[model samples]
Target: MAQTSASPDVATRALPATWTTNLHLSSDTGLLQEGLDALEGYRKKDPNKVVVRFRAIGNAPIMRQNFYKITVSNRFQAVIQFLRKELGWKAGEPLYTYINMAFSPAPDDTVSNLFKSFATDGHLIVNYSTTAAWG
Candidate 1:
């Protein structure tokens, strides 16, 4: 069968900034905590290696809701893959994302550069809304 050029029927509503910048990593809290524990293991195993962390962003840990943040002295790749590949998280879902790098300006900042790194760097902050997932 010949492949056809296709277009969507409607325009998509854009997500806010927070979703894109920091990585949410996992939708499930237990998994997120597991990842943190694994990081702790890494800290013990390789004390010399740079330490990275997935710290909770909001004041409370909201159930069934994605709310978190992460910090890395270096080695962003390690944590991104651990959550994205190993954990089998909310990836491939249409999730709302907000991205910025420490005081960077947004609102039409052209996130192509940011988007490239985010393929593996970003966290799954806000949980996936079905409309965002599959409208």
Candidate 2:
């Protein structure tokens, strides 16, 4: 059998035994700490209250004032249900809502977390439409 030689670069290169540990420590520790701090703050928020402003889209009817102060512990579903009732929508009728005209959140998501992440100018701008809107 003929012998094969490894490339010079490959032969000279050696893997560090503690590469994983070094990588873990070196990978954006400051950003990681900031993220952890944000998470801690999210988890430790007091009162857990958020203010929301609802805006009608397209042909949707406007609400009176349309601003509400809600508890952060409430799920997104409560907002939907409130809207449906306010608009006198039948149970089977479809309604769509989005945050900051960006995206719709899950019904089970907490209002506090959503407010912390998406609220602007001291209020969460909730856009609603009777037809399908943004994803």
Local distance difference test, each candidate: 0.36, 0.85
Which candidate should be chosen as best, given TM-score against the real structure? 2
Per-residue lDDT of candidate 2, residues 20-96 (tens digit)? 44554657878779889989986764565678999999989999879888888888999899888988889888889
The CA-based lDDT of model 1 is what?
0.36
List candidate 2 segments past 4 Å from native: 1-46
Ten contiguous residues minimizing lDDT sum, candidate 2: 1-10
- Compared with the true structure, model 1 gives a TM-score of 0.21
> Could you give candidate 1's per-residue lDDT for residues 12-118 as a string of tens digits?
54346676544555567886798899889755422222222232233322234233333323233433434343234466743222333222223343223333344
Model 2 reaches what TM-score against the true structure?
0.65
lDDT of 2: 0.85
The residue pairs found clashing in candidate 2 are none
In Å, residue 20's CA in model 2 sits off its true spot by: 16
| TM, every model | 0.21, 0.65
